[model samples]
Structure formats: structure tokens, C-alpha cells
Target: MDILYYLQTFDHFIIYLVASLLLFGLGTFLFKWLTPYSERDLIRAGNVAVSLKLLGKMAGLVVVLQSAIRSSINLIDLAIWALIAIVIQVVLHLIIEHVFTRKTNLAKEVEKGNVAVGLFLGGISILVGLIVAATISY
Candidate 1:
């Protein structure tokens, strides 16, 4: 197979969807690492809306990354892949934290136990990656 062809496949699937999952983890760790305030403290401070807001912030960061990647790559097909990746990330995160985990608030779950949160994040990434691979176009 051509190397360019292989790269395209990787960009379409992994760069888009797989990267999104990674960005989620990256963003999560970033905020957790840098913030003086705990997720619970942020919740208690009530200066914000809710946990959904945290997800929103992560989504925004992913979007910014997607935009930067799209600009750098300058390929319509690749940009589409990035869009799919970001959507996969957000959708999967929401699904587990909301649909599967039975937790109304994801922050709470993470606060309860870090290990379980890490597992959930990784599990959702794979689930969403598989779904994106199955559904997205080349």
C-alpha cells in the first residue's frame, strides 16, 4: 500500500476520532493538574453553571485543536475527519457519564474515585473510536 494512502486512513480514523478521545484525556489532566480549585470546589463555588460546563470547556478545547489541525493540514477530507473525531469524543464522554455510568454528574464520579474515572475515559475512547471507524467516510 502507498504510504500516502496509509496516512490518509490514519488521519481519517485516528487523527479525527482517536485524537478526540486523547484530547479529552489531555484536557482533563491539564485542568486537574493546573487548577488550584478542585472539581468539587468549582462545583461548590457556584460561579459556574454545572458539570456540563466542564465538558463544554473540554469540547471547546477540542474544537480549537481541530481548527488548528484543519488549518495546518489544509485538506477538506482531513478536516471532516477532525470534525468526526471531536464529535465522537464528546458523544462518547456524555454517553458513559450520563447514559452508562448512571452518574448525573461526571465530576462527582471522578471525585469519588480517580481509577474508575480513568477506566471510564479509556473505555469510552475505544467505544467511540470503534463507532467512528464504522460510520465515518474516507
Candidate 2:
């Protein structure tokens, strides 16, 4: 009958976990698909694409962190903020082609599926879970 009740339920946790994973996974995919370099080019240029993508995947840590904060902070507002961040990232990419020094990212080579990135994202999910659990008692 209360939010605490919801938090104790496995279904609630599963739903949150699954949804978070899917969104982060899908976002990573989209970023990869839109990246601008080929494997051949990276090979010829000393693997700059992978390096750059690694940075992005790492920096993307912030996105997942924010999402975790949003999960229990205010779901609706968090969604709106995420949309804004996406727009900003896209715009920044579009406007900075000349300043770019790396080859480009294809999304797949993000450190070979970026196990670290995946783990950190899941960690964020845990943070969300803890926050929800903590808030439930209040």
C-alpha cells in the first residue's frame, strides 16, 4: 500500500534494473551507430577511434550516474533532463568536427563491448536501488 511495499517487491527491483540496462544499452548503441570512423581508418591511424570512443564511454559514466540519481530523485524531471543532455551532446558533436583529433567511434569497439562501462552503469542502477530503498522508509 506504500512506496516501501513497492521497494521490497522483487518485481519492482527487476523492472527498474531491466529498464535502466535497456536504456543505457540502447543509448550506447545509438552513439556508436552515429560515430564517424571505420575500423580500417582506425587501423591505418593507430587506433584513434578506439581511444576516442573509450573516452566517450568513460565520460558517459556521468550520464548513467545522473540517471541513477534521477530514478529516485524525480523520474519525470530526470527524463526531461536526459533529453536535454542528449540534445547537448549531439549538438556539441555536430559543432566540433574541426576540433576533433581522433579517428572516430563505431560504437562496437568501445573497448570491446566496454565491460567496465557496463559494470559502472550497473553500479549506477544499484545506487538507484539503494536510494529507492532508503527513501521508502521515509
Candidate 3:
């Protein structure tokens, strides 16, 4: 009976793990699509700015997913929260790039290897993720 209970728990763990991974992949895809430049190409070319920016985005999404996994009532709820987190991160990034820094062309700067802007954007992304994660509690 104890073994049976453990097996059932393991099954749930697997389900959640797979679901979380899928959500993470989807979030990353959407983020890349929404960005102005190709993060993959930039990173491949040894652009530390793009690398740092992408890292922050990934880290932010992971933090949000962690909260969703902990607080969600079911798999569906987890999925919903994960989507919300992705949207929030992407939207906030756009807002910062377009609105907050109207004078500066962030995309161009990032492409030109502006580490300061990259670090600022990366820090903001992580900050937004932390805030969004904190709000995910039931």
C-alpha cells in the first residue's frame, strides 16, 4: 500500500514536470518571436548583450513557473498561470524598450553590444518575474 501511494505520487510528479517543461518551451518561443532581433543569431555571434538579455528572460520565466507549480491547484491552472507570466514578461519588456527609453533605440544598442542597456533590461526582466511570481499565490 505504501508503495502504491508512492507510485501515484511519482506519476503526478512526472505529469507536472512534463507540463512545466512544455510551458517553458512555449514561453521561450513566444519571447523570441516577439523580440525585434534574433536572439539565437546574436548569441551565436558572441554578443554578450543579447546573451545576458536572453538569460534574464529565461530566468524570469523559470521563477514564474516555479511559483505556478507551487501555487496552482491543477495542471490546467498551472498552464494558465504560466501563459499569464509569459505575456506579462514580454509586454513589460516591450514597454520598457519603447516607452521608458524613447530616446534610445534599445534594439540597435543591444545589437551593437551595449552591455549597460543589456544589464538594465535583464535586471528589469528578473524584477518583473519576481513580482509576478510573488502574486501567483492562491
Candidate 4:
């Protein structure tokens, strides 16, 4: 029973797992930067609406990650597709904010305990995630 052999066998799995986590963090960071208000702050203040919207964003990223993981042939391939997915989600957020939350401030709405806005954004995020996931292919 060689330790090196076991390590080698698990290297790919470990590498991919770490890479996925890093990608997830990057995706979330990008989202945080794009938004006007502080998600952490809002959530800390017990704002269910902010949490709901953030939940959708996270779920959307997971959907994208699932597609990338299933479709990627290698780590580099995964990275490329993951980045593309991130871009798509970011763009989707912008579109949602502009189209759905147009005439009002999304950040303020969420901070003010607007469950309707939160639910709407959450639904939109999941829908976009499904679309992105379905379209990904190896």
C-alpha cells in the first residue's frame, strides 16, 4: 500500500474540488462587487429579502457549476466554462435589475423587507440558471 499511489489516484478529484470552490468564491465576489448594497450587512440586519435574492444568486452559480463540471473535459476546460457561466449570471443580474426592478432601486427594496422583489429576483435567477445549465455541452 503505497501512500504516493493513493495520493496520485486522488489528485484529480482533490484538484477539481479545490478549483470548484475557488471558482465559486470568485463568482460570489463578482456578484458582491456588482451589487450596490452590502449583502453581508443586509443579511446581518435580518433582512429576509436580501437573503432570498442572495440565495437565488448562489443557486444560479451552483447550476452553472454543475453544467461546467458535467461538460468539461479538463481543468482548463472547466475554468473557461465556469468563467463564461459567471459572466452569463452577472449579465442576467444586470438584465433583471434593469428590466424587473426598473423605476426602483433593487438594493433599497431588498433592504426595506420587500419579499415580492426578493421572490421575483429569486425566481428569475433560478430560471436563468436552468437556461444556462441546459445549454452547456461538452
Candidate 5:
């Protein structure tokens, strides 16, 4: 293969990689804004529940981003789809939390280190991400 061709391929790879990272950062910021409590503070205080929940959200976002990158016709398309996926994940998570914790408070439980609730929330996030990713084709 020509060296110039390989260099061009690498440049494209770098551009996509950078774009994906920026999209992931935006998604993370959005998720934090939508949540009721401070995940960063809770995790800093050794709250496993918040940690798990955050991890799930990150993983879910990655799944959606991957799909967006694969299906997009251009960088702009990928960014748009990624943003839509982030909004969907965050909104659906809020709805699920409200529905499941009608008699309790998800934020409080998570603050108290309720691992089960965290795991459940995380699982729901991943599930939602998978569904959204699957629907992103063409």
C-alpha cells in the first residue's frame, strides 16, 4: 500500500475518534444535568450505587455513539444522531426512575448506596441504549 494512502486513512480515523470523544463528553454532561443528585460527589464519597449508575450511563452512551458512527453518512449526521440518542437515554431513564420509585426516591436511595437499585437503573440504561442503537439504521 502507498504510504500517502495510509496517512490519509489515519487522518480520517483521528477525525472520527476526536468527534466521538466530544460527543461522549456532551452526553455525559447532559446526563449529569438531568439527574437529581451529584453523581461526582456521591462517587467521591464512596457511593457504589452512583458509580454503577454512572458507569451504566456511560456504557449505554458508547453503544449509541458506536451505532451513530457506523450508520452516519457524514460527521454532522453522526453528531446529530448521537445527540438524539443522548436525549432519548436521559429522558427514558428519568421516566423509568419516576415510575419505579413512586413510593421512594431514587436519588436518596442511590445516595445511601443501594446497589440493587443502581444495578437495576444501570441495566435499564443499557437496555434502552441497545434498543435505540438497533433503531438507528438508515
Candidate 6:
């Protein structure tokens, strides 16, 4: 293969990579904003439950985004789908916090380092990610 040809392809790859990173950052910031409590503060206080939940969200977002990137026909398509995926994730989080755990306050529980709540949230996120990823198609 011609070295120059390989080098030229790097430009588009770099662009895609940068765009993906930006989307990921935006999604994460949005998640923080949507939540009722400060995840950062909870994690700082050594809350393993909060940490696990956050980790799951991050992992889920990446999986969804990876699907969007792989199945997108163009950059614009990727971006649009990414935004949709983010919205879905936020909605899912809300449902988990409010609807599913109606009797219990998930945010409060997580803040108090409840590992059961954290595990549930973490597993839900991963499951959502897989489902969302599977739904994406070119």
C-alpha cells in the first residue's frame, strides 16, 4: 500500500475521532445536569455505589456511540444519532430513578452508598446500551 494513501485516510479518521469525543463529553455533561444530585461530590465522598453507576453510564454511552459511529453513513448522521442516543439514556436514567424505584429514593440511596441500588442502575445502563446499540443501523 502507498504510504501517502494511508496517511491521507488519517485525516477523516481524526475528524471522526474528535467528533466522537466531543459527543461523548456533551452526553456526560448532559447526564450530570439531568441528575438530581452531584455525582462528583458523591464519588469524592468515597461512594462506591455512585462510582459504579457513573462507570456504567460512561460505558453505556460509549457502546451506544460506537454503534452510531459504525452504522452512520456520514458525520452528520453520526451526530444526529448520538444526540438521540443521549436523550434516550437520560430518559432511561430518569425512569430508573423515579418510576422503577418509586418506593425508594434512588438518588438518596446512591448518595448513601447503597450498593444494591448502584448495581441495579449499573446493570440497567449496560442493558440499555446493548439494546440501543443493536437498534442502530445504516
lDDT of every model, 2 decimals: 0.52, 0.46, 0.86, 0.86, 0.89, 0.86
lDDT tens digits, residue span 1-138, model 6: 699998989988999999999999998898778777899988888999989888888888999999999999889999999889988977876776678777877878888899888878977888888788788855
> Per-residue alpha-carbon lDDT of model 2 for 1-138, expressed as tens digits?
598787788685576556556555555555556555453465455654454443454355345435444544554444444444444454444344324324653244433455453344334334433343243322
- Model 5 residue runs over 4 Å out of place are 1-4
In lDDT terms, which candidate is top?
A: 5
lDDT of 2 at 41: 60
Tens-place lDDT digits, model 3, residues 97-132: 677567878878888899888877887888888988
Report the poorest 10 consecutive residues by lDDT, candidate 6.
93-102
Per residue, candidate 5 scores C-alpha lDDT tens digits across 19-78 of 999999998999888787889988999999999988998889999999999999888998
Give the lowest summed-lDDT range of ten residues in model 2: 129-138
Error of 6 at 5 (Å): 2.7
Global local distance difference test of model 5: 0.89
TM-score of 5: 0.93
Quote each prediction's TM-score.
Answer: 0.41, 0.44, 0.91, 0.89, 0.93, 0.92
For every candidate structure, what is the RMSD over all alpha carbons to the true structure, in angstroms? 10.0, 9.7, 1.8, 2.6, 1.4, 1.3
Evaluated against the true structure, the overall lDDT of model 2 is 0.46
Ranking of all predicted structures according to TM-score, beginning with the best and ending with the worst: 5, 6, 3, 4, 2, 1
Per-residue error at 128 for model 1, in Å? 1.1
Local accuracy of candidate 1 as per-residue lDDT tens digits, 72-104 = 454455555655555555555555556755635
